[model samples]
Target chain A: MHNRSGLLEACLLILLKENKSYGYNLMNDLHKFGFEEDSLNISVIYRNLRSMEKRGLITSSWAESDQGPRKRVYEITADGEQDLKNWIWMLKNRKSQIETIIEKYENLK
Target chain B: MHNRSGLLEACLLILLKENKSYGYNLMNDLHKFGFEEDSLNISVIYRNLRSMEKRGLITSSWAESDQGPRKRVYEITADGEQDLKNWIWMLKNRKSQIETIIEKYENLK
Candidate 1:
């Protein structure tokens, strides 16, 4: 699979910014946001969360869950908010470029 | 750098569909089409051409040039045209998805 880890990271930032969340719930939220279960798994989400934490984009803390085990909850840092803004800018720029290419392809026909 | 090789291949197919072209000229055409020269180089063009040929998406033939060494010109095969269509479809789908994500982000603000 061509990993869309960049897009995944962007989505993660968006979710964390709204409210601090743990892994399992975040995965569910991703599905609600249009990510298919097959397209992403818990491992990928965890890896990205860890990477983002290392990059200072987010921070994590363990919280006691009412059930089974303690959960690691993630929250967006100030850096994460800035990165999300950058991602939005880049995505908008790329959308315009793709639009141009699509227009060119249509005109050729 | 994140390799946008897939997008590069789509652009190459579009150019080939218009008319057969060699690597150097194709690079220039890409620049005119909004791909920055720094974003793509001759080697990347040649690499994609070769890979596309391997996949039967394009075919190449050496043509003698009066001013320089013989150049390999590339043309889109029937499969290349089909692949180009697929690429456009995928790009359109991705554009919509990106738009959805952007909208979600804006709504959160």
Candidate 2:
């Protein structure tokens, strides 16, 4: 994704809403959703997760894992759902704008 | 526009392609293209313009104006046109991704 930080956030919200997950699982889900592992920075996702938690969009808690001592589990908050809705609305608006630009480009002579 | 720096660059390129314009006129054109003047930061546009020039996507020159001392005129370079094409391609891809996300959101229950 090219400069898709906001899109990444929206995707994370959607994934968490589907099921509360840990960082590793979320990263895997991101790959499943078209994000290239090589292009994605794990630290960036963690930073975004921390920032979202600070903003009350997500909450993280330590959970005992079968193979590990403990893992941080992330769940979307009500605010995250609302934020996702807002993101969708904004993205829809942007989509139309992009279409307009493309149309204009095609018409250029 | 919410975090639409790339979109802004595309719009600027389109406008410059249409005509080599000065900063003020470009800003006005942007307003006509759905950008709210109040929401836009003039400095950011100038910063982007300077950055584009530095990257050889655009070139600027000082021109004598009818009523002002001199104004900086901006023109899109050949590289800029190619960059515009790339931007359009990327934006098209992003548009489809956005549509997919919107569809997923709508289907969520």
Best by TM-score: 2
**What does candidate 2's lDDT look like per residue over B63-107, in tens digits?**
998896799999999999999988888778777877777777787
Per-candidate TM vs. native?
Answer: 0.88, 0.89
Worst 10 residues of 2 chain A by lDDT: A1-10
Per-model tally of clashing residue pairs: 0, 0
Pairs of residues at least 3 apart in sequence or in different chains that clash in candidate 1: none
TM-score of model 1 vs. true structure: 0.88
DockQ of the candidate models in sequence: 0.52, 0.52
What tens digits encode model 1's per-residue C-alpha lDDT throughout A52-100?
9999999999999998899999999999999999988878876887888
RMSD, candidate 1, Å: 3.3
Docking category of candidate 1: medium
Chain B of candidate 2 vs. true chain B, TM: 0.87
Full-model lDDT for every candidate: 0.83, 0.82
Residues A1-109 of candidate 2 have per-residue lDDT tens digits of: 2335378888888889889987777887887556655867788788889989999999999999889678899999999999998888778777788888877778774
How high a TM-score does candidate 2 get? 0.89
Off by over 4 Å in 2: A1-5, B1-5
> How many clashing pairs in candidate 2?
0
